[model samples]
Target: MAPKVTVLDYGAGNVRSAVRALEHVGAEVKLSRDPQDIREADGLLVPGVGAYAAVMDALKASGSLRHLGYRIAGGRATMGICVGHQVFFEAGVEHGVRTEGLGEWPGVVERLPAPVVPHMGWNTVQAPEGSRLFEGIEDERFYFVHSYGVLEWNFDVTQPAMRPPLVTWAEHGAPFIAAVENGSLSATQFHPEKSGDAGAALLKNWMGTF
Candidate 1:
């Protein structure tokens, strides 16, 4: 059977393209706000658009936030896209307002240091060696449209038995996280849904992990 994936629909918009893209890659997609479905799907995709604080509020209002936390903490397969990716961090500071995030990792999503706001367009990412997300398309460019990002990475697994996250980088006046492959969780600053063939391959790669 095709991998069963649930795309969290907390009214953040821009989710239809993601749903279409996932289906194009053979995923059985379900767009839902149901918490049980969120926790039990073979893979869970959190797709977000718009401001950081607004996205968080929507997730909370729909009661999907707690279940999202549960799924991630339980080490089930989960992927975040765009603002969905941003909320994985501890906090996000947009328009001088600081909002708490899912805290899946330690870092703050801040405005890019570049003179250009949004940093919209296609760009290549420096995928780390052994990165499964960019496996076959390591040299290809992906779509990106956002102004805020995690400029620095501080999450390091100190335990000798644990593996650290494989981080990818892209620049817009300065370097920022492009994608991350950390255990059961994976995220990309770029939108694979809008990334064309390369994005489909990337999504297919993630599905292969399940």
Candidate 2:
């Protein structure tokens, strides 16, 4: 049977593109705000677009965040896109407010310093050796538009880190954590759906993992 993947809907996110991407990859996909839908999914895709605090609150209010932890802890495959990636960290320091994150990974979501509030446009990403998601996918460019990025994390050390530590694949002239993967959980600060062929291939690779 094809893996059933759920694209989380927290109201603060635009899940249509992700849903289309997953469908394009041959997986059975659904847009769900219910906790049960997430619990039963073979893989989960958390996609978001909006402020850190508002998105966090929407996830909690929908009860998807709590169930997301359950899915990850159970060894199920999961992925976070853009702001969705930020919410996986311990907290987000945006707009002078500190909001709690899912804390699945040990990191803090912080804004890019001066001259780089929102890193927009297409950029390249290099996956380190032995990365499952980047198996056949080469160093390709993808679309990214975001103001905040994952600054640092301790979770990468305790467990086997994915991609690389402290190396920026491509950014607005500065390096930052572009992508991260640990076990079955993975995240990228870019929009794979908007990345054209390269991005589609990356999404295909992720679904193929299951």
* Root-mean-square deviation of every model: 1.0, 2.8
Q: How well does each candidate superpose onto the true structure, as a TM-score?
A: 0.97, 0.89
Give the top-scoring candidate (TM-score): 1
Candidate 1: segments with Cα more than 4 A from true spot = none
lDDT of 1: 0.93
Error of 1 at 166 (Å): 0.8
Instruction: Itemize residue pairs with steric clashes in candidate 2.
Output: none
Worst 10 residues of 2 by lDDT: 161-170
Report the C-alpha lDDT of model 1 over 15-104, residue by residue, as the tens digit: 999999999999999999898899999999999889999999999999997898889889999999999999998999988999999887
Over the full model, what C-alpha lDDT does candidate 2 score relative to the true structure? Answer: 0.78
Q: Per-residue lDDT for 141-208 in model 2, tens only?
A: 78899988776545454456453333334455455677777778888889988888877888888877
Best candidate per lDDT, number? Answer: 1
Error of 1 at 205 (Å): 0.4
| Count of clashes, each model | 0, 0
